[model samples]
Target: MNLEDLRAVRSRERSSDSLQDLRASFYEEVADYIQERKDARERAAAEADDPFSSEEVQTLTDEIETAEQVAEAIYERRMGKLVKQASLAAAGMTGDTDGLTNEERRLYEDLVARIEENKSHVLDVLAGEVEPGAEATGDDDAEPDPIDAAHANPEPGELSEPADDAVAPPDSARDESSAAAAMGGGLDGAEEPAAVDDAAVSTSRASDEEGDEAGAERTTVRITRDVGDVLGVDERQYSLEAEDVVVLPEENAKPLVEKDAAEEL
Candidate 1:
């Protein structure tokens, strides 16, 4: 619980990949020890005629800071081991839990439970036992509409069939009807070419407008460092490297530019 004790624990944690056994009240003791040093430092400052000249207060202050750093280092190292242990346990490869304090044990259990739950759901989806984002219809036996059924499962050759109620025209009448139809078709076809041209122009203009809108939302930047793969705010994946020039959504580009990892172009 003293400064030397804190340093020794930190050294042991750094030397060993596995967590070292410690008392269940180890962190509580460390906190109490730091608080005691702070109180002592304050008392020494008040008692000394010249607080700035007091060596005892200075020593206590230094010890408090060092103890805090050492405690934090030990905690980070143990936490890393606990996270790895939790992952292994979730995968059915349980590790030693004897070294965990009550709080850490609870955290470990929670992590394992979450990992297992996620894995189970993902595996069920992969196995096709569950559908992704699918909702239950609650009526499995409900019949499909006739119109929808016909469209989904059309009969072969049905589209090519003619209506049954039809009459044949006389030969002379048919010849006159064909002549009149040909003359009307010639007149309509002349306007059809112009209509087709207008449609092409309209489609091209729409595509250009879409391109301009997309350009406005994104920014051009040059990568100064290798950012292997990043997920953008726009939900697009970008693979970038040093010296690569690319366009990214403004939100995603801003962070990189501020970090000096990229320059806005």
Candidate 2:
């Protein structure tokens, strides 16, 4: 397909119902194209006394061969999708029926039944025991586990000091030192640990109260631009678009309002 035609097909692929309708029409068109190619091949054969020697015959044959190749590609794509759906259904996942109609449901069930009849090979294909086609768009490299990576790679503020002696006096030592300085005499080494504990308890209580306030307070903002996209929030892109109203935590809402990208709603 030409770029524009492929773009149009991709645009239509967003909704499931559209795909269900488009599949039949697309298959019919492919079948017709294949039939036309076969007719052309026969005509090409007749037009050349030596079909293999004639450039025109060779070109016609190539086009005819291309049509069949394209048809097979389309067929395999449909098969992959059907197999995925059937496997997911067998595994009890039925999410995202936004565009699936009753007819589509029946077709899915029929495919599932056929798959079950040859369950061994079908299961192998689904389980990646068999590579059905090498036409997948995604990188073959497996993605890293996000939760594991996050735990392994903590944020900058979360990084621990090598020791209390490193990076100046950390909060623990500073709080104790400040408390001693405020007392107009340095603390005894024995009392310094107690001073640190007291400071830690105070800090913990303050953080808990602050967290409670932030959690309890929600703010509504009218977005001037798509903050959802900027923040990489999935499925809620529309909610964070320009001129859209969204509710967020007060802590999150304050900066956007200050920047004039959003206003309180």
Model 2 residue 109 distance off true place after TM-score fit, in angstroms: 1.8
lDDT of 1 by residue, 170-233 (tens): 8756654543332221110000111124444455456445646876466666666444455554
Model 2 per-residue lDDT tens digits across residues 83-175 = 567776656676233334344556777766665555555666799976785333223586767976775787877864344555665765665
CA lDDT, candidate 1, residue 120: 79
The clash count of every prediction, one per candidate, is 0, 1
Give the Å error, residue 258, model 1: 16
Count clashing pairs, candidate 1: 0
RMSD of each: 26.9, 25.3
Please list the residue runs of candidate 1 whose C-alpha ends up more than 4 Å from where it truly belongs after superposition. Answer: 133-265
